[model samples]
Target: MNQQRRRQMAENYLVIWVDGNINMANEHCQNTLTQLCGVVNEVNQCTTAEKCIETLQENSEKTSFVISSGALGQHLVPEIHGMPKLDGIYIFCGNKQRHQEWAKNWSKIKGVHTSIKYICEKLAVAIKQCDQDQVTVSIIDINEGDASENLNQLEPSFMHTQIFKEILLDMDHGRQAIKDLVKFCQEKYQGNRKELKFIQEFERTYQSTLVIWWYTRQCFTNKMLNRTL
Candidate 1:
């Protein structure tokens, strides 16, 4: 496995919360979970263990983490244990001692939470660990090819340029740093002066790095094509 494969696996994860009535869970904790890891896609809230099981049946390959309350954990963990796609389980309870004792029986249960904040912190930490594990996989597959072969695969179209720019912005680089990155790309690629000036003028007003990145890729692609021709 390589970094790219690991990243694909990481992206396939589905973070879900399970309980009798998910609405009873504190909204703040839910928001925190979303803020920390919800970017994976959406935070799935399952009101019942049955629904969660059914969801897992269809999406197990994408189910990385399942969060359940202590009341539901006893029944839910048994049903989902040994499933192929379940990386780990996190269970929260008002009773710390009971939750800890119950968590001991399962090797997959990574933590026992006594409070919503505690569980949120634990989930965030575990997700980071999961990402690290994915990153640690040894690279075993490699394909050697000629320069022209690789170049032929590089279909640098407008869409490709836009996608690359979006990825660069999604990295959450700071506003000023993004401005600098756009300017750097323009200079490196000898991009259009007029477009660069437009970006410079609009950069402070737009309040979004994504717009800046988009224009930068556009001008950079033009220069690159001219140079190649």
Candidate 2:
């Protein structure tokens, strides 16, 4: 194959984790994912959150992106023609993380950067139909992360409870080649020994598709909205 053709066949992918509480709307986790996914969706043409991630995987050679939306794209993006293959992930947690002493417990997430109400509204209905225990889906930011002083002191047990990390092996900053997970699972690893020599040539991580929006918000939106964008 020609060099161009060989390059076109290369695969790229992103690994993402969908927290279980987001699906259950616990502690307002659903609300938090909404905004983060919203800005990602604003730029993507994909209809559902799943498709958004699939789009990143399919066109990975050209562009790679990742977003977690409680399997939001299962219905919306998959039905389309160009929808890419998705690497699915789910994250679970016990009711002990954010806040301290009084702030600890199963509280919903707060201060999500975006809004995912449209999708969460639909997921809520699905849970109800299953006849399971009462499920509440909330969106939480959890972005403040686990290392916060509050959670550390109050819920020491919740420390380092990133469950998905057990399965997903991520190297800090462009570790194991871009899209290594996808190629491994799809069995498309080409076994290029030379590429392995230059492993540090590039740093791989979730490149935000929302850069432009965030800048736009900082520039124009802040001016028009009459507040910090």
- What is residue 18's positional error in candidate 2, in angstroms? 3.4
Write down the lDDT that model 1 would get. Answer: 0.59
**Cα lDDT tens digits for candidate 1, 1-229:** 3332233221335677787755527886656444433223335667799988987887866546888888999889999988888987878677878778767999889888766566656665665555444422122333475656544555444345555546545556567875775665445423234445544654555445445444334233232222222
Lowest summed lDDT over 10 consecutive residues: which window, candidate 1? 1-10
What TM-score does model 2 achieve against the real structure?
0.19
What would the TM-scores of all predictions be? 0.52, 0.19
**Global local distance difference test of model 2:** 0.31
In candidate 2, what are the lDDT values of residues 39-74, reduced to their tens digit?
221122233455445556555543222233323422
The per-residue C-alpha lDDT of model 1 at residue 52 equals 85
- CA-only RMSD, every prediction: 13.1, 20.9
Q: Which ten residues in a row have the lowest lDDT in candidate 2?
A: 220-229
* Poorly placed runs, candidate 1 (over 4 Å): 1-10, 24-41, 132-229
